[model samples]
Target: MKRNNTFFRSVWFIAISGLGGFFLSLTGLSIGWMIGTFLAAALLSFLKPSLLRHDASKKGVPKYWLFIGQCILGIELGQKINLSFLHIFKEYWMTIILMLLLSIFFSLLSGFLLWKYSKTDMLTSFFGTAPGGLSAMPGIAEEVGANTAVVSIIQTMRVFLVILTIPIFVSLWASNPVNHVTLPAQTVSPFEFEKLLWTLVLIGIAYGGYLLGKYLKFPAPWLIGSMVAVAVVQSFGSLFMGHDMVSWWPHVVITLSQIFIAASIGSRFHKSMFIGLKQTLIVAFLSTIGLIFSMIMCAIFVSKVTGIALITAVLAFAPGGIAEMTTTSVVLNADSTFVIAVQVLRIIIVCVILPPFFRLLNYWEHKKHLSSHASA
Candidate 1:
């Protein structure tokens, strides 16, 4: 019972942190709140690396909670997927490619600069400088004996700074950053207890699937399975039942859900683990230059090819992850969709590209060392 309570409390902390940051962003209070929160999360992580490190929770909540979040994202994304718009946007594909190449080029640059200046090995330094997940890269970094700590710190700090600065920058540059959309008040056509019961059953399915995923030691099992299952069902229902099957779901529920996400992300930051502040500050300066230079190149590339606008591409392709780019795009009034799509693509590329590159880098470096020793 005590352990269960602690889990609940921690999850609650995480959600609340997300909510607090979202509200602050909406109210225009702290453009930097998300970064502040992430920084706090890193601090929390350093202090208690196990704060939300529950393999169980990581395994469990997504089926029930995270699945719902993904559906919302999909719904938003699906709504935006216009065939006509895409046809027009098709010409921009080459531009997107150019933008992607620019990201890769700059990522290489950031890696090289870090390698030259720092004691970290080229391979670890290379992957460590990657932008997506601090967790994902550091693990890869350590396997080959790269400076995982430096990579972890640099990546986290890069995310931290992006989250803090991007929104403020976007809002400053955008034509009209705050354009809140109000949804129509929902009214259900009729009550069907049978369908309601089934929806509850589906939620239960998600719950159980998440738990089972934990047992299987799957990564984000809850999120992956629940999202896949619910999405499949939801998509099928829309195809057959004709859009009215899920009318009764509440906005209040969604808002609350988003808050939970924000808080959970925020609680990642605790007050400890900020020792040797000068070293952190120095690395932060270098990382900032790298991110800025990379973003500027991306923005210029988008401007030349897509002709969509410079600032939007820059905000979208900025090396920071989804949360920062999404929030900043919203706050800055840039094309959030464009920003998100590119960021998502960036993530996909990193997840796919980083591992192979790491392996190759190790092989090449090892061969180089052996050659040098033989010559000596």
Candidate 2:
């Protein structure tokens, strides 16, 4: 009976939060459902903590919901992978590398600012300011021994600011008004026996990949693993079939996935996160603004050098997540293929490089401390 009551209350809270998101989406906000729902849930968790509190025996939402969300997101991204798009980079390889380097440089600068000004540890600052996807960063932070809560909060704030500001900036600066962004039409396979078989096969592959990633200890293992599994299958299948594979997940399913992810992240925040973190929060906000500015400048440089439109370049260079940035590009009729490619490339590079770099930093810091102690 107690479990039933808790379930009902959670459903009510999520429903109200979804409604809030719906209203916000009506206001022309990009990714409003995610932002609105998250804010609504976080506010509730802050103002009426008792309403969201869970005993040791009962949890607010099942962990499997989040895993399902990650799988949905992975499959969505996998469906977007077009092997032919690799040809687009042939002529612009140099510019792409330069943009990626600039992205790393700006992230490092932001991390330094956070470390010095916010007094966050070096590892947390680096991971928090990393330009990787929000889905990946917090998990990576935990792996690197960073302060997960602070990293998650700061990374979330950075993404929220980028999504809120970039569209408005583009609308104001562009020759035409940037209207509300919408996802491009996707080709979806019909509900047939073959499609059902493929869906089950894909789910099995995702699960297998998740287990393998867990064994290998990959950051955001479920996410990256499922993405790789689906993408490889889709890519090879398309090569053999001589056509692109259609998306199997419907729109409603994707929306539900987003809601699950957003609500889970939001509910993790509590009022205590703010008790003694004023300076850190303020520094995070300012560093995020700085990071945005730096990326904008890099976008302009890429635009001038490569002859791509400013909007496309901005979306490509934006530190926002792949899903959000790609959606923005589609809505604005920007070069979405290029945007996704660059964003994915950047994420791969960051995830591969940052962890080792962080370990080196840790090693050096330890050595320096020991040297000082010996001198003393």
Q: Count backbone overlaps in model 1.
A: 22
On a 0 to 100 scale, what is the lDDT of residue 69 in model 1? Answer: 47
- Candidate number achieving the greatest lDDT relative to the actual structure: 2
- Tens digits of per-residue lDDT for model 1 on 1-376? 8667666756655554454446555644232344333344344544454545354222222223334543343332222223322433465667766777777777777776766665556775677667654424544454455554456567767765666665556555667555563322334335577666755755765666556655764334444334334544554555565442453344344444444333333333333323344544475458666666667766865577657766677777777766556656555556766776676556545644665676787798789999999999
Query: Native-vs-model 2 lDDT?
Result: 0.74
TM-score against native, each model: 0.56, 0.82
Where does model 1 exceed 4 Å of error? Answer: 1-91, 133-148, 164-284
| Model 1 weakest 10-residue run by lDDT | 56-65
